[model samples]
Target: MIQLITLDMAGTTVTDHHEVEACFAMAAQKSGLTVSDDRILAMQGLHKYFVFQTLWEEILGTTTHPEWQMRVDNSYRVFTEVLENHYLTHDITPTEGCLELFEYLHIHQIKIALTTGFYRKVCNIILEKLGWLEGLDDTHVGTASTTIQASITSDEVEKGRPHPFMIQKAMNLLHISDPQQVINVGDTPSDIQSGFAANCRLSVALSNGTHAADLLTPHNPSLLLGSLHELIPVLEDLRTRS
Candidate 1:
């Protein structure tokens, strides 16, 4: 049975509109590095620091730039400021059909978990702005609908996407022990890899958020949908079978 659904923030459940990439590129530019839009988009769903490290590595052509750590730290510090202000200043909203999906899962007694590449501060800003910050636990925030069982952020986990730590942590917080009972959906390759690594029953991908359908296809997701509105049928079918 699918007891829980773990969804990603930003480009997954939330409408991103490339604001994240813009912020990252802005920070990179400020830090004396030229980061391409494709490169920034490719790093979506990774921990912000790692994103900075990787970009810096590419710019310097080695992981061992003499001041690599310093540069990474400086760039990340700037990125965080830019990202936080961007979110706080902008009017953030859930992606199309995101709330409907949450409601459907709620009615079916399926738990909703929100996991994000963002650290707690930025993630909370987005959540609070969307009015989804009610019923928060010490470690995480809950949705306004009370359907969200857990919220996991990169800051709360030892690692981010492409690793199963955040998903596993959400499962743990939600009191869900079986990875087979979980479905993970996101809009990035890292999202797919993380779900697969978590051993989830369904590693679903959404194409409407960040990457294109073609960009996400090679990850071999168990299911891929262009929009969140199409999620119900896929989930209902799984419910019937399981």
Candidate 2:
């Protein structure tokens, strides 16, 4: 009885390949802050600006610092440029069997929405590159799998993952109520937390994306999957259970 499935953009539906963390790391360094890859990866599924804000605060050891906003802004601006250029110049691919999963959901009359921690501009760039924007309507773009019902981004919401704003926004736009009829799938702890906050019937994680199974495990999703391909059977099973 699932009405909608909200999937994350990077690291969940799209391939990460460590590019995101690389960009963040470079941006941090450019802003005069040194950060580890693990720390950057741990911040996945959060709003980009908030990520810099938190990192800057921690690096400087004080939120009360007068230059906090300036530093955060500088780091975030650099990160956005780096990330967008990386996606635009580099090859980006969707996760294995991602398109097939979209087709299955489409055939079942289950709407799919992409909810991302990324801002709208870069999201469009990635979608366009993958041809996911083909035949796009006002709400969403179409891919080989199916036409998405909506594409919600972090900037579109008051807050990002772990706050459930993006998922909630997608549900509202797609006219989906009853969180029990929703499935939120992601590759990070924040993604799992966000789904649960929305009370989704299925809050699942994919280890093949961003965080490893070990990192996502403690978040306690309904299940942990390896890739989007694995979710097809689970969805079919859920249909049967319904």
Candidate 3:
């Protein structure tokens, strides 16, 4: 049986109306980078800093150049500002059926953990807007009365998506040792890749987020969902089979 369900924040549980991509585009433009929309979307679930670093390297054709770090720093700085302001000023809400899914997990006694590509400050901002941060400690670990059992951010780990550090850290905090007892759910390829890298029992993907089904399918997720509501039946089926 699955004991823990690790979910992605933006685009998965939280509604994302291409605002993130817009922020990235604005940052890239301000930093004088000629990145395309597809390229920006492709980097969607990665650490913001790393995304800039990689993009700068690709644009400059070498990481060793003196301007590379400066470009990365400038782009990331702008991105942070734009992203944080967007979340602070704009309306934030849970994705469709997110609350229902949370209720189902609660009833089934399955712990819910949120993992995000966002860093701490912005992540907290979104959570606060949705009131999902209530009752969580400084470390973002929730008690029995909280909405989620734990929350993990990319900044807290040495590496972000496509790496297992965040998920492993969540497992550690939740006292879950076996990946087989955990289900990873997200709406990005990096999220799915991270789950697989962590050896999760199921690396599920949602196609309605940042990327489309065609883009996420190449990552080979165990299951692909079109909406958050579809997860309940999948979990029920898993419980029965297990």
Candidate 4:
């Protein structure tokens, strides 16, 4: 039986209407980086700082270049400013069926943990806006009455998506040892890759988020969902089989 469910923020749980990509583009423009939208989208679910570092390295052909660190820092700073401001000033809402899914998990005695590419500050901002941080402490770990059992950010770990650090951190925080007892769900290829890297029982993808089904398919998610509500039957089926 699945004991924990790890969900990605932004496109997976929170409503994302390309605002992240827009922020990345704005930052790139300000930092004089010539990046395309597809490139930015491709980096979704990665640590924002790592994204900038990789982008700068790709453009300069080498990280040893003198201007690499400066470019990466400047672009990352701008991106963080833009992203944090966007979340602070704009309306933030849960994706469709998100609350319902949460309720289902709660009723079923399953633990819910959120994993995000966002840093802690921005992640807390979004969670606060949705009232999802009510009972969580400064570390963002919640109790039985709280909406979620844990919240893990990319900054909290040594590496982000496509690596399993964040997920492993969540498992550690929740005292879950076997990855086979966890189900990971997200809307990006990096998210799928990370879940599989963690050796999760299921690495599921949602097509209605940052990337389309065609784009996420190559990552080989165990299951692809069109909406959050679809997860209910899948979980039920898994429980039965297990």
Candidate 5:
């Protein structure tokens, strides 16, 4: 039986379009980098540091240096300060049907794991802002919140997506020995790749994230659902078939 479900954050769990773009723009300017909305939107689903390095290099005509990394770090700290203290409070919110889905999964005795490319600090800030930290410790939630050195490290080969280490770590943390008994629900192609890397029994992509249905169709997900509202019904149908 599928006993665990690993979820992705960002566009998958919380909805915040303007806040993300505004922060990126302001951070880029403070770091002496210039960025456009199109570029920022195009790089959605990528890790924050990678996005910073990529955009900084693209804008400043050079790759990142240690000093540049420091600047980026400072800019990001300020950005996150604003995000957590203000923007997040005003902008970020959970998707439709998220609460109902969480309750259903809990009642079913299925473990819920949350994995993200983001470091624990940033993840904590967002989760705290959204009141997700409490849920992270619930019996049903398995979170990748440990120190990178202490925790099973996720690989970021050739970019974070289309690689599997993040999801694999989630499984390990959740004590899910059989990937075939776990399901992954995410909003990006990287999520699918992680599920495949972990050899998950099932992977479902949702249109509620960065990409639209027509765009993500090319990635060939096991199934595509419009929103979290469809999760229970889809799983019910899968159960019937089995």
Candidate 6:
């Protein structure tokens, strides 16, 4: 029986299209850099630093620099501010039926854990601004903080998605040791790949993110849901069988 559902944020919990493009545009303009939309789209489902590292390498032909880091930091700071001030502030909307599905899972006593590639500060800021952390009396929803400056050490078993570290870490914190008891849900190929690598019993993919249906279909998720609202019936079926 499934005991927990681990959700990925960004393209999963929150809509990412207009907000992301706006942020990228601000960052590129502020930094006097030009990143193509194709490049940004290609780097979806990756950590911000990883995306920055790639863009920095492409634009500067080198990935590391104190000055460049500051520039990137400043640009992203402005970008986040813009997201809060404009994108989400004026038009923050949850994915279709996400709240309903979340409530359904909680009512059924299923534990929920949220993980994301975003660093702690950014995640907190967005969650706060978008009201993602508000009015929740539920204890089942757990989110793991991805320490922004933590150096990667040898003991780290995973890096990021397409690595399972984030979700695995969330489950470990939830005290759910058996991966088979957890359903990993997300909205991209990397999400599917990460859940697959984590050995989740059910890997659910949604077409609401970087990957389109054509790109995600071949990976063969345990289920592909068009809307989060659809999970209620799926979970009900799972419960009946159990």
In model 1, the runs with Cα more than 4 Å from the true position are 141-145
Kindly list the per-residue Cα lDDT of model 1 for residues 84-123, writing each as its tens digit: 9999888888898898898899888898888999998998
lDDT by residue (1-242, candidate 5, tens digit) is 76777777766666645456677677767766667877766666567677776666665557645466666677667665654555435646777666677777676666666666555656666666666665344332433432111122122233465566666665666677888878887777777767777788877888877767876678788889888888888766766676
All candidates' TM-scores? 0.95, 0.95, 0.98, 0.98, 0.77, 0.78
As for TM-score, the candidate ahead, 2 or 4, is 4
The Cα RMSD of model 5 versus the native structure comes to 4.9
Between prediction 2 and prediction 6, the one with superior lDDT is 2
Off by over 4 Å in 3: none
Q: Candidate 6 residues 38-146, lDDT tens each?
A: 7666666667556665676677666566567766666666665665556435545567777787777666767766667665555555566656655432332433331
Off by over 4 Å in 5: 59-75, 135-162
Which 10 residues in a row give candidate 3 its minimum summed lDDT? Answer: 137-146
Candidate 4: the clashing residue pairs are: none
lDDT for 180 (candidate 6): 90
Note the residue pairs that clash in candidate 5: none
CA deviation > 4 Å runs, candidate 2: 137-146
User: Clash totals for all models, in order?
Assistant: 0, 0, 0, 0, 0, 0
Error of 1 at 176 (Å): 0.7
Error of 2 at 121 (Å): 0.8
- Model 4 Cα lDDT, one tens digit per residue, 1-242: 99999999999999999999999999999999999999999999999999999999999999999999999999999999999999989999999889999999998888899999999999999998999999998778888789999999999999899999989998998889999999999999999999999999999999999999999998889999998989999998988898
